[model samples]
Target: MFVWLTQFILFRLAFGMALLLSTDLLASKQLALNSQTADFPVVSYCVDPDWLPYEAIRNNQHVGMSFDYMTYIGVLAEINFSLIKTESWSETLDKLKNGECQVASMLNRSPEREKYLLFTRPFFVGANVLVSNVDQPFLQGYENIGEQVLGTVANYRQAEYIKNYYPNIKLKLVDTELAGLKSLASGDIDLFVGSLLSINAQIQKSGFSNLRIAGIAEPQDILGMGVANGDQVLLKKLDTAIAQLPEWVHVDIYKQWNNVRVIDEIDPRYIFGGIGVFICLIIIGIWWQLIIRRYNGKLVAKNSQLQALQNELVEKNRRLEFMSMRDPLTSMFNRHFMQDRVEQEKQVSLRTNVPLCLILIDIDYFKAVNDQHGHVVGDLVLQEIATIVCSTIRDMDVAARWGGEEFIVLCPNSNLDDAIKLANRLKDAVSGFDFNTVGHLTCSFGVAQHYAKESFVEWFDRADKALYTAKDTGRNTIIAAK
Candidate 1:
């Protein structure tokens, strides 16, 4: 019974091509034995007119790989089918399912639509690939794509696939594939994920030389055509027609659409750059050997002096960079950086009418800890405490070491109550954390909400006063400013 039920479902899911084969066309050998049983020979098919290489109407003429294949099938079956063009893929699918259109060309098959339609044996197999602007360097692959923002068609399989695994990649879903392509060309997105064939064709038509393929997506089931689910007779007919097609049909289709060349790997600049660097290294090595062989005491001393100066310069640059907006020892944003960030947050909150809150945290009995543990251990504790605070804050929230043992957290769009609750959570998280060799630690925090007329510094002073109150009244507690 299970086998019979499966067979019944499979048959109903296929096309109605069997009805066409059994007509008078079959008596004349024009139609196959598995052709559809329809009379009067009325056939209707749906195609996405804007999709290139696969299906598109250009200059009042419809020509595409799928269109040609369907035409070949029509000629063999002696069926006169009316071509129905739709602007969107979803609309075309709707036409097919509603019986307004009997065939849909070039659709991917997946579980989402399996219950509603039958898929043909795949006519062509291709991959979704990354496309980038011509001036930009090609991405290494999806693995190295975190820094880039990608654009793609909404509801396309590539977008869904990326969202499933590459959650860190920034994705902007456009209305259509062409919109995604245009966004890539306009620099709206660093990369666009689309079909290799279709994107290449669109690029050629638009005369876009700067756009190129970055990488290809893994082929999967989401790429195929859809037919009404109850069309078992049609499925057998289409399957028979597909099996009988010339082996060269696939090759011909590919050749007809092969205009865009996909770059399967990285650009030559890096490759050439690496070779140049290696040659330089070899030359330097030979020079170093010669200098060693002809060693003069004075020149050797000069070389050592020059090396020391170069090291000093490098160290100076490193220190300068480290000190820019950061406390070097704790690796937290310095007071200057915190002030600028808070000012920006205040302006944004004023303009958008959004709530903003600030939390001032101080290490409880920090001076006592320094006296007992030595300044070196106190420095370690500060570093450990900074790490704890940074880890506990949300990505959108900003945490900075305001100065010395005090740190500030800027929470945007958070109200007074939410800020108080979050302050308590952070206090708890810090208290519960085991700081390894540092042993038990606690912090006192002052939380304050922003008022519309208050300046960034004004709001911070309120939070700061609360911190002093927490320290005075007793440590290890959170106080909210009135």
Candidate 2:
């Protein structure tokens, strides 16, 4: 019995390791593929006409979270997308089914749809909510959805899930959320079932002041990108692109659509399992005390081995965390890390009445460095500049590579004047540095101070415009945005 228990525990441990290893391998594959150009130059996708906040077509242009997500994917994969416009939400599905378009973004998985559509792994998740007239009592679940008609956009997977799981709920198919909300407000339906964020946006925009959230209903769907039937090539391509993205990429996109921030998740099942294992081991130790003469040395050796394994796992996790937050070439913090720090510092500044400042730095005529001296020398110049900025900044300040030829510095307790001074210091540092073979390099600087009630993006944009002003006037200079 003891031997079997030991084998079972070992098997669980090995299974956990295999899961982590497989995940790492998948991410590595995504990285490998994302760094290269995709087989297709362009891929077209069908767009829903009025699925606001997640996707919509406005004035012939695709807009919202899914559009932003796929745009990033296209940029990384070196592919282009032409969003094929459809007349209605139902039409969007038909376009993909009939192969009128090759891709559809944020498509929920369904067994019926799977027959004609290939789906990538779910890249985002959101819950289905019931929106109803403000007079309606808050609904807790779909099971309570009795004889009253439940309004929903036609062909929505949310509606489909309801049909499959709770067939008794009367469904009223509508072309859009606007119509559904109108119908509900007029006593034509009990509730409208859709994405919580989307329903809220529609209510606010269309003057559905009479409508309110009846309650959040569940079976939160995992959303994925879908391609035409048997389009494994495109499906795999999208999956790889999504896998290659950092967690912050998804966070940024979600932030644009929803006011709420997504919290990092922990697997409670594993957590509880770990606690159970600890308790089991304690009981085993009590048993072992009776057989100390036979088991003391074996237990000690086993515990030592376990301690070593724990240390090794911790070290590996530390290295991975560091690597994820930094730019490999420059050895500087990357935008992901910078964004997180800015958010933290911004909240602190707001709470304490302390000033926060941002500086945007851009390489002046950097393309010339790559064009004339080759990318190797260009990279070296970037590395050298990163080192200078790292050395010049105060220990309390944070710096990060924002993007190609651009960097940012965050000053936690500094005002506009202080930020300008720091920018000038960094500007001087870069200008004075000897590039060995590449010669001297200069950078343009932009400074901006945060203001009450302004968003993080707004603050960043102000500084970015300042950087542009410096570039327009000349290369090596500073500009402060008002």
In candidate 2, stretches whose alpha carbon ends up further than 4 angstroms from where it belongs are 1-40, 134-137, 259-482
Best by TM-score: 2
Model 2 C-alpha RMSD vs. true structure (Å) is: 26.5
Residue 372 CA displacement from its true place in model 2, Å: 73
lDDT tens per residue, model 2, 1-482: 23322432353353334433545643443344433434437788887778878888898777788876775576445566767888887788878888989988777767678778876656776656777675566576787767878988778877777788888888888887788888988989877887766766665455454565666566555677888967766766786778675575587777667643222355598689668766766889766455654555775675565445444433433344345467988989888667756765675576458899998999999999999989998888888888899999996688999988999999978999998899889988889888878888899999999998788899999999988999999879999999
lDDT of candidate 1 over 1-482, digit per residue (tens): 23322332353233234433434442344333234323326567777777777777676455677776775565455455567767676787678767888767667654454556776555565545677776445454578777878897765666666777788989899877778888888888888887765765666545455666665554332233456745766665675666556555566666656544333354598689668756765879777556545655665675565445444433433343345457888888778667756765675577457899999999887898788878888888889888988988876688888888898999988988888887888889878877656678889989999998897768888999998899888888888998
TM-score of each: 0.44, 0.46
For model 2, state the Cα shift of residue 464 in Å.
56
Winning candidate number (lDDT): 2
